[model samples]
Target: MLLMSRTDNAVQRFIFENTDIRGEVVSLNNSYLDALEAHEYPEVVRRFLGELVASAVLLSSTLKFEGLLTLQARGDGPLSLLMVECTDQKSFRAVAQFRDDIVEAPLQTLLGKASLLITVDPVKGKRYQGIVPLEKETLAASLEDYFAQSVQLQTRLWLACDGQSSSGLLLQALPASAELSADARSESWNRMTALAETVQSSELLDLDHETLLVRLFHEETVRIFEKEPVRFICTCSQERSAKIISTLDRKEVESIIEEDGQVAMDCQFCNHQYVFGKEDIDSIFNEKPQIH
Candidate 1:
């Protein structure tokens, strides 16, 4: 199924009634494509970016701050870096770095000796980051381990991308709620996760939130909250890029402008290009940069 054809770009949060298990379902269409269009990525990079996007959105739901959460992977192989940044408002952008001649291969071969980094940058407080070895073959597995060790949450993620759209399903074992015996609580977590283990990529991409939930948990009571919208929003602009140029040494910016006639730069995240003329350069360096 083509997930881009789906009209709703939303993430649905749901909980099993009388249980402490909460989960999220996400589908990406335009946002996923927007992130990929800036560069011509290989098949492996495309699919890898998709999974990272889905995972970022899923992890963003767990934060309580109005800031950006970033997931970064880097290694010594042909594929050097995979980065996804998502905001608390459910918007995201991603980028990757790789050698020009790298071919698709196993995860470790594409990105040998890798480590994963999860960072939360709150708008009003200190940032926090957790680092772990990317010892798993799939991004999902690495993330599952991150949650297990870093947050002490039993989290499972299923992420899929087919070069057009990306989708993900996340199941987390929250603290046990009241109104259940210890046995019932334990059984509930175990049984629900076992059922979720049956979910396939096709089911996640093809099924709507409600139908998918019903299909998976019809025998179990569940409550889905209002769906949240997800969007493709980039934090790049001519204004911001110019400020970065301002921070550089004045002579270097002038030398580059003299040689190339202008300083042209592309945003690392969205690949949006920005060009600075002589006047723009002077204004940036001689005066304070204007921000909107």
Candidate 2:
């Protein structure tokens, strides 16, 4: 069964007519699966990764900047951390860390006393970061709180993932023009949020963008924009790994060589391992460092 069609593997933005409401939809299949294959995550971690992947895509699509957005969750549970990063170029990467015997449970069950951290890094500008405590029952609810606090906008999000495929929908009230009254904008936001809350996980993950829009907002007119492709691309290599190794003290490097006969570094995002034996370490120490 085809979970995501080639034509459907893009981020889409839409706006409602005669209202200050905007929304985005993202369906990730290949990118979601690629992130999963990078590590042997538990079932709970897998689900969290899926949600993070979908949420990252949805958030990146709505932003009006050319940069990267990173979504991460850290907790004091069996599942320690989960992260997803996506750039305006449509490239992305993700990874998760968890104990082997993590129980299969809901988002709250797996991540006790957790927090969500979002970072936006522009290619040529200042970066922005937001940290929100995980007080809600689900990842989607926590994100809604983040949006409410950061943007002060009425926002709703529906996120879902089934190991292989992940998808999400986000709707937010836009800042109204000077002519529009605050009460009018508030009323419109409440009405649209009510409509957005009825979205089912099955519909969000399985249905295409057009079908989803029609099912959820048939009563309203929404202008759908062209979709942008989302893909999985890891930015890790031996050269980068070597550069990182160059940062370590020479004593620390020699200690690893003395204990294990070699030093190995693995890319958490791609699972690509780089090994440096004594000779490799010597060459690294002997050669002049190049600016990376």
lDDT of 2 at 242: 78
Q: Which segments of model 2 are wrong by more than 4 Å?
A: 1-7, 283-292
Give the root-mean-square deviation of each candidate in angstroms: 2.7, 2.7
Across 134-208, the per-residue lDDT of candidate 1 in tens digits comes to 999999999999999999998989988888888998988877665357788778878988898888888777777
Off by over 4 Å in 1: 1-7, 179-183, 288-292
* Model 2, span 135-157: residue lDDT tens: 78889999999998987777788
Candidate 2 weakest lDDT stretch, 10 residues: 1-10
TM-score of each predicted structure versus truth? 0.92, 0.91
Candidate 2, residue 139: how far the Cα is off, in Å: 0.4
Q: Whole-model lDDT for model 1 versus the true structure?
A: 0.87
